[model samples]
Target: MPDPEEPDVVSATDLETPPGLEPPPTAVRDLLAPDRRFVSARRNLGSFAKTGDAARLRRGIAQYVRTGYGGAGTMSRRLGSVSRTARSLSQVLDPGAADRGLDRALLQGNSVAEITDAVVEAACSSDGTLDAEASRESIRNALSDLLGLYSDVDLLRLTDAQREFVIESFVAHDVYRRFALDVGKHLVDNAPTATIGLSRLKQARNYIRQTIAESFRLLREAGQSMTTAHVRSTVANALTNSLVVFEGYLA
Candidate 1:
């Protein structure tokens, strides 16, 4: 979990973080006053990262729940063209989306989720905090899937990756929205230990990463086009299937 617990007057270099990941500037802080949740979460993150005591992580989660974890990170959004730009894409809606059962079968595929997510994410964003690097990740994921699953397809034409960006951004946003939301829950649910919690957190993040990537692979094999209704319906359907997958894993 990220916490903006640093000094209010840090340098320009202070915000630099590793590529392909959301920066640590997630939690809101006052100019002169430290946020209580951020201060506590920072302490917990530092402690768990250092000592491997899952109790610290667990306690932090409880604190977050008590403090109201709502506006602290990314938010969930509708799956269709969630932005004004999405409307522009609608001009190109595939005429065959209804005819070919693309919306029916591929709704469970990766492409629909990727495309709808790509658009709807804008609607979900509260302000202009969109990350530039999200597209790079989705594109890579989309391209890799093309190489693995649909090698004969033209790379330039295949574009579930934009959808990939939407979902990736969604995940990144969700994590910060609620500190320690799921990172330590599994470990603490069974037993509280930071080492186990850290490991569980890794597994959870990996699950998210793999699921979205696997989901992106099915978006192409044709020039991409779909109605806004198709977009919403397919993505919604894809999300349901994803939940089933997630539930199976959790079970």
Candidate 2:
């Protein structure tokens, strides 16, 4: 027979031994077996680059857990596990995540709840720390995504790949995303009424909204936890600060 340590049911929360209880790490390991890990990675990617109007990140994760894992039952169970883990982490809400989702809602047209839910999920799951390798990859990814979004050259410089890479790599991922989100939200919330044309106003709104959305998505997908508000305030206080080295790149 199998060793007594192996249990019939493997779960993230089931961290006890057979007949009694297993430990969480063992359960997480069993659940994250190579094949399961592959599935999780794939589902995560699906959450990132879907074609349809952006859906709530929370909904996407929940659905992935539900169907991709076991079902609604599994989602509830995993949620319980995640909730417990969340209690241990610091609780700074990133306004950028909220603004990014809100901007997306205004543009691609999702509900406020859907947008807010996604923002909350992003904020909660954010880790904000990327080592050298991941940071390099993130910089490349950020630039590519930005180029695709901007498609124009005047508003923000697109060259200086090396400088941009350095800025992105050295900066705190969550903090940068937070600031970008803040800038975007503030612009949207305080768009000048004196603007001449509807076209100008719409363009400005789209630009700010898209910028925040892209930054928020990048930050969340990278697993950084810094909120948009934090980043914004930090940058505003001292534009040359280490928290947002991007401004340094501009200089």
Candidate 3:
């Protein structure tokens, strides 16, 4: 069995709903809406990490294959495609449903050590099969890419407290409650100015940064005194590039 405490690398397969919640049209529209898109993707990535069901993975794979081939390319290009789908799903589903499913899937029957082991295994794999070096590179490169995919709105909404809460929950609860909370709050706020695109972009970037920072921090800290080289470097590069592409959205 995998070590109980290790973090698991959530795969695309984790996002599918069981029989009943067959995605309503309203939900789908919310997911596809420009303002909601970033939030949607954030929720979806959290959902995907928890469930790991094949159907969800299929949707992600279809998206991945369609947008860009994964095996070879700049890491950003690959993660950008996958991240978009994650955002869409996050936007479409009820945040409650996503949270519940994720919590159930992750906390089912493992110690923290086990979870950590699973994460290490997943990181080393390519397409769910083990390949240590590939997995590491895939993880680092893809995450760097994924974080880069966020937009200005994404950065604007996330507060430091929210980020800390997300990291805590992922460790204790195995669910990204912050994502759901953010989306729920977003929906309830009902700001007319927030377009689906902007909303989604905002949500997506928040998840990307929080997840990347948390994971990188944990891994870097696990065995030795941590260094900021990779983490800061990655974030800095992403911020720089994002500024180039997302200047219009920035106020």
Candidate 4:
């Protein structure tokens, strides 16, 4: 008997071809022998990570430090050059430091750009002794670490439509929220023109939707599942970082 959880396999002969598309004859045979692994796997989204937000952030930070610092000698040397206040790199590279620097910035309601800058700076050099190249590398490593955490999820179980839906809803909510906030601020400021042009608003909406769709496609290609919490957090970060563009719709 077929598994109750599995979707019914439809024969290609019974499938109606959409307008303007002609499927090859082999398509029917291939459909009859679909990949069993994918067919049997759960199709719904699951939690991206089992840990809480703080723990997830700390794990990401620790991974970044370990991967970026290379060795204890290098870390020590970097720390020594960066600061005289601390005797060890652990003082700044550990989870406590992540809590103090990145977490603190987040809790203080800093923008995503500010938080990202702060986290990268704190990771690169606690006392700010890193040169431009080193700082840039640190920022790259920091973002990689954070994005890597979410990219670890298995996305093969989800259908393309499901992934698209999650991404679209996430982007829509973020755009709507920012648009509402900007309009409210304009009203409060008594601006000469409180209304944004419809064309500009449409452009902004299209840009955000395209961005979100492309981001989701890349993540899906990388085998990352789009969980509800992960989608929300990712969209929030995007909105926070793109506040200027989002607010530009008002102009």
- Candidate 4 pairs with clashing backbones: none
Instruction: List model 1 lDDT by residue over 109-168, tens digit each.
Output: 356336444433333333333332332333333334435555454322335543334333
- Candidates 2 and 4 compared by lDDT, better number: 4
Model 2 lDDT-worst window of ten: 14-23
lDDT per residue for candidate 2 within 134-247, as digits (tens), equals 222333333344445555422121243322332332232322332222222222223232121122222322322333344544654666433332333322222222212221
Go through the candidates in order and give the clash count of each: 12, 21, 41, 0
lDDT of 4: 0.32
Model 4 C-alpha lDDT per residue in residues 140-213, reported as the tens digit of each score: 33344334545542222224443334334434433333322222122112222212222222222344444445
lDDT of each: 0.36, 0.30, 0.31, 0.32
Q: How accurate is candidate 1 locally (lDDT)?
A: 0.36
Predicted model with the maximum TM-score: 1
Alpha-carbon deviation at 100 in model 4, angstroms: 34
Task: Score candidate 3 by TM-score against the native.
Answer: 0.22
What residue runs in model 2 are displaced by over 4 Å at the alpha carbon?
A: 1-131, 152-251
Better of 1 and 2 by TM-score: 1
TM-score of 2: 0.20
Best by lDDT: 1
